[model samples]
Target: MSEKRIIVTGASSGIGEAVARQAVARGWQVLAVARRAERLEALAAEIGCETFAADLTQEDAVAALAEAAATFRPTGLVQVAGGAKGAAPLGETTIEDWRWMFESNVIATKRVIDALLPLLRRSTAAPQQDGSASYAEIMVVTSIAATVSYQGGSGYNAAKSAEKQLIDVLRLELFGEPIRVMEVAPGMVWTEEFSLVRFGGDQAKADAVYKDVQDPLSADDVARVMTDILALPGHVSVDETIIKPVAQTHPWMVHKGPLVAKG
Candidate 1:
């Protein structure tokens, strides 16, 4: 039996999927959660981790997920099932898009955390001889957009920023507990669906986001960081980390083409 059990959201694709794969490789009992049953099933068959399908934004779905997860007694929660719906300026963005953004990014995160926190607490591992206990963890995958604002990114920026703030406060609220709250804010990840979905399925526009950029961050790159952090002793908490490609200094400050030495 695996020593640790972790709940990874967004396991249907992208970063969450990558994290689940790596966690399983490290001998973790992973409850891979996502909305798509097929993808989660495929992952489970290939990697031998369990899967749960749920749309976290729905109250009934989250309640159901929490009840199911309680059976496994998860020691960790990884919130990564979030996205950007549109790339319009604040005035041009529709209220529908804004609502979706908040619901998917911020509200979904809150719902999952609220419902599953008790399970995490109950599953805390025994303290080791090194004076460190294997504490429960809550790791969120925020974005660099959470901290940096750009034109036409108002909705995503606000929603992600709010999500980051929620994680920040959660760390404070759980100060005396053995629960560790953390977040990884990545910049310019070249995921297959992120930009495409943000641009509303415009392939060309999504392609343009990474056009000529040399080696943008990949899902595996971010996942490596997340898993490595989780592997650390429970006494050590990374708290917060921001990851980005060298070509991406900020949302608007991406440098296309190769990086050459300046004379």
Candidate 2:
């Protein structure tokens, strides 16, 4: 079998980084994409995968990325480059922050998909032993914020909700085609920078988000779920998966231990 090729966006950190590393370990030819050249370079050095540094929000950069990706002809595209900017209530959320969230989560995802559709289509052209078409997968890493609304999470909720809807529509549009669209919605993942970024680098504030939370999900945990979905038989598609730690049931409902403040 030819080695499988995959492109993972947001490859500089968090779930994106984890997915890229895991993909490479499983013998896939990985193309890691992110805006940070230094981080991508470091990841490439460690994992021996190809890297592309481009801001997905920029049309010119996305175009260049598409040109590069055409040569790879990847069978899978994992979109994981997204996050929340501020935890402000609807009225207090800055328009700038809301726009950033939408651009980062929804618009960026759409752009990358549009740019890579041609390469993704190539996966279907590969010959199969059964004379049936092979499948190409597009897996999006969304958040539980899409499904449940919480106080002070309006911007994030709206952005993720849009992304989730987009994925659903894409799946319906591509139903008969060999392309498979799937989404994984994770809750309370405690990565090194997720909370910090959301809280504008306030270390104490970031740390407080996960304080006393038992075994919160990690980037690797989410990556494992993504790769497992990809490993399924070509004909089998897990349309949507929601994963969270046992302590978390929804966006705001978390069972912190007694020592943790409940407020």
Give the count of colliding residue pairs in each prediction: 0, 0
Q: What are the runs in model 2 whose C-alpha is more than 4 Å off?
A: 129-132, 258-263
Give the TM-score of each candidate.
0.96, 0.95
Tell me the tens digit of each residue's lDDT in model 1 across 74-169: 989999999998887688899988999999999999999999998888876566456456588999999989999999999999999999999999
**Model 2 TM-score, all chains together:** 0.95
Q: Which residue pairs in candidate 2 have backbone atoms (N, alpha carbon, C) closer than 3 angstroms, thus clashing?
A: none
Candidate 2 lDDT, 61-174, residue by residue in tens: 999999999888788899999999989778888999898999999999999999898788877886766666688889998999999999989999999999999999999988
Residue pairs whose backbone atoms clash in candidate 1: none
Top lDDT hit: 1
- In model 2, what lDDT does residue 128 have? 69
**Candidate 2 lDDT score relative to the true structure:** 0.90
Candidate maximizing TM-score: 1
